[model samples]
Target: MRWFRKKSASTTKTIFGEYCATSSVHGVRYFSDPERTLCEKFWWIVMFLVSVGGCVKLIESTWLKWNLTPIVVNFENQPISVTEIPFPSFTICPPGKISKLMYNFAKEAKQIRNSGAHANAYGSEDCFSTEFE
Candidate 1:
């Protein structure tokens, strides 16, 4: 199988050459023409303002339909209850209280270590057992 095939022809003519060439004429003239008339500038400004207004209207309608309208409908159908909603509540402990709790935890951990309870809790005797096999 041939991996790299050379193109048969150079300077190939495209079927839509006229369409592409005609389409670029307006864009090229709009950008490259320095001596534009006042009428052209006014026309461009009108087009820009109209486009912006259209975009704003589109966004407003979309927001109303997708976001605001649904919220309003939901509120009208089923009113929100404070007790039914599970709002997050935080218990803010002082730094001193947190430190005291940590100290107590460490003391209990040290006692468990001294009593050999921590070693037995790990069940190290089962480490070499082949009970599963």
Candidate 2:
């Protein structure tokens, strides 16, 4: 038997076959190769499916986490020298009844009321602090 074999004209290159052979995606070349055994092809298919499944699961979890989260606006009570904040930069206060957990206006009011010297001054001033739980 001759070691060197002649090239056959019977084997034709189709569009899909050429694409699969030269695909940029990983494992496609080996999976599409005609010379590879059935076991090798099956293994490639399994690996491809596992990678796809992992990617899909990652994307799904991320999407759900992003959507399920509530929009939060955090503010600190640190004293500022400026009486009023300039335009553009501002604080976000919750609408309706503010949660006692976040802030207790009643407690602050009680402290101010107990301070004798400042009691009259605070009582005279028009303040929104009167509306407390």
lDDT of 1 by residue, 68-87 (tens): 44532234466864456565
lDDT of 1 at 132: 26
How close is every model to the real structure, measured as TM-score?
A: 0.29, 0.43
Cα RMSD for candidates in order: 21.1, 16.9
For model 2, give the 10-residue run with minimal summed lDDT.
Answer: 1-10
Which structure among the candidates has the greatest lDDT? 2
**In terms of TM-score, which candidate is strongest?**
2
Residue 81 shift from truth in candidate 2, angstroms = 29
lDDT of 1 at 44: 60
Model 1 stretches astray by more than 4 angstroms: 1-33, 71-133
